[model samples]
Target: MSQTRSSAVFGKRKEPHTIIIAHGDDIRHFTVRPWMAALCGSVLAAIAIGYLLATSYLVLRDDLIGATVARQARLQQAYEDRISALRTQVDRITSRQLLDQRLMESKVAELLDRQEELSERNGRMLPLLEKAAGASAGSADIPIPSAKPEVRADIAPANAYAASAVTNSAVAALARITKGSTAGKAGSASIADRADLMFLTINKSLREIESRQLEKIRTLTENAYKTADTIVAALESAGLEIDATYGSSDAGGPLVPVTGAESFDSEVEELDEALSKLDSVRDAATKMPIANPAPGRVVTSGFGVRRDPLIGKPAFHAGIDFRASIGLPVHATGTGTVSKAGWNGGYGRMVEIDHGDGLTTRFAHLSEIKVTEGQAIEVGQLLGLAGSSGRSTGPHIHYEIRRDDKPLNPVKFLKAGKAIGTLL
Candidate 1:
């Protein structure tokens, strides 16, 4: 009986419990099973555990955030490294481009400098070229492009304009190339190559111009020397020795020894020397009394022993008489200063000119005296009218050429005048 009672207690302990609640006239009852109680306890335990887990998550939240941020930072660093690498590659390419552009620019600049130098040289040589062209006007071998008679009066304008055009073209080409380069255009290398070719062409053109100028100058120099030599020979033929130092008597300068390689300046100096020699010889020829005193006149009286027309006797005739009509113009034969322009003892209305180097010319038996004493005279200037004055027969004039008061034959002088005229 005690064992049964203990088993009943154990069964009842495992059975559901009933609880009742009453209010005034209403009553309600609920049966709570042992499983329900266990479920409730389990639910309560689950809630407590969830709360503890939530609290732990809240405590470690900052660490988790830090970890996530660290990962993001690493990713960002990797991305930044990649970007830097790309930028480095771009910079290298840019650097190479810059180097190439600079090299091209330097080459172009060098070419420009050379062109400018050539232009300056041309500017300085223009006057000389023009002078040479004028001196050698009939020369055909010299290829002076700008030496035209119509334009010879002004050659500088055309040449200067052409040079300016070339410079402008070069500047335009440079601008185009620079613009393309700045715009990062393609085919920059080809542009630079074209620029080089164009610049080379310009340089070649300038060289050709210079070559033509040099050729002209050379021809002119040769012709000037030839002219000088011919004049000297003519003077020697006329019994006049050309003084070597005729033009250098008053010239004085420092004796700077020539010490340089042959160049354009040296060539120009040689040309100047040749021209100077030509001028000196020409001056000497001019002072010689070798021109005809009275052209187109018949010589009635001769020099040396001649029969005098008035005296009807053999007399020493110091000059030749030309048959002329009264009031006919008489001209001076050479350039000189008149020393006598009055009537002399035997010569009437005599006009005597003192040419340099002891040379004198006399025109006598003139009806009129057109010059005064101590008057400067030139060749072909009218001296007086021809007529029969003193010791003259009919209408005749006596012309004389003397050296140091000694009479010389005028025939040889007139012949020399013809020869000199042909040469000049």
Candidate 2:
């Protein structure tokens, strides 16, 4: 029977069951578990997350590297630009310094040239100064030393020294002129050498006393020039010829020489004699009248055309008449030698002065003549008394101005007198 049973038809096949293990307990349960599917899904998810994270990290790293490279490149470019700018500034400053140096050199050269020119000019002026000194001595009223002694002695050596000095100065000036543009140690040494030479030559002829005298002469000459300028200015103010007032013979005339070399030589000889005479004349004139003869008076008659005082008729008046009392003192116009002091035809009790330069003045119709012929009279000396001694109606002084024996307008001379008086 047992055999017939036949394995019980699958032998009660194990009930479709799952083993559940909970808390270490195993139990048979008719259920299905999906752990394998869930595990598979979890594995897939983990793989995806890992891929995303790797991609993000790689991208971030690449971006950072690119940014760093760009920043570095920009910084490098900025530094390069700054360096170029600084180089340009340095170049400009160097160029400016060079220009300034060149300008300074040019100015130095110009100054040296000017100094040389002045030295040459001074050399030319030395002879003139000596001549002026000689002339001044002769022009003085005091006696002067004779040149015979100095000339007879050996003055040639002094002349030679003077000539040598001048030559050396000229050479030094020329050297300075030539090398003024140079600016090195050699140039400096050359300049110093030239300066020393010039100093030595200048001091060779000039003693301490001579230097002082020269300085005084220079001051006096400057003062004389100023005086002459003042005189010219005053003449201009008075509407007179400036040259005429300055004692120019050919005032307002052309500078044409009369003759050729022969005439020029003769003229030169004549000029030398004239210059000697002029020195004496200047001395004499300095003692002549420089002020008014009569005070508190006015001119009643002017030189030139006027009606005759005795008769009402037109006549040429040769002199100006000043109204004054009979006892009024008549004064000399300038320092001079009295050429005539006596009664004349129309001018009773007259006084005449020879003031050189072909100029003369006459005071007529005086009460008494005080000066004698050939008497040296000083300026402002009493000459006579104003009176109507000649053909006059009243007491007055008749003054006359003559040049080369010809009568000129006394107005100009009188104005000159007034100017001189004011100055005094």
| Per-prediction CA RMSD (Å) | 9.5, 20.9
lDDT of 2 by residue, 1-424 (tens): 0112335557643333354555556544334336755787899999999899889878798898999999999999999999999888666655544543454445445444544543543454455445445444322322224521211112222443454455455555645544463454454455555655554554444433233333333333433343344444544453433344354545476676554334423433443344444444344335433345665679888889899989989999987888988878998877778999999988988999987667678999999888899998777788888888878788889988776788877666556556544322
Which tens-of-lDDT digit does each residue in 298-398 have in candidate 1? 88878898777777899888878888899999988888999999999679779999997788989998999999999999878999999888866678778
Summed over model 1, clashes come to 0
Task: Give lDDT for model 2.
Answer: 0.59
lDDT of all the models against the reference? 0.71, 0.59
Local error of candidate 2 at residue 378 (angstroms) = 1.2
User: Would you list the clashing residue pairs of candidate 1?
Assistant: none
lDDT of 2 at 239: 40
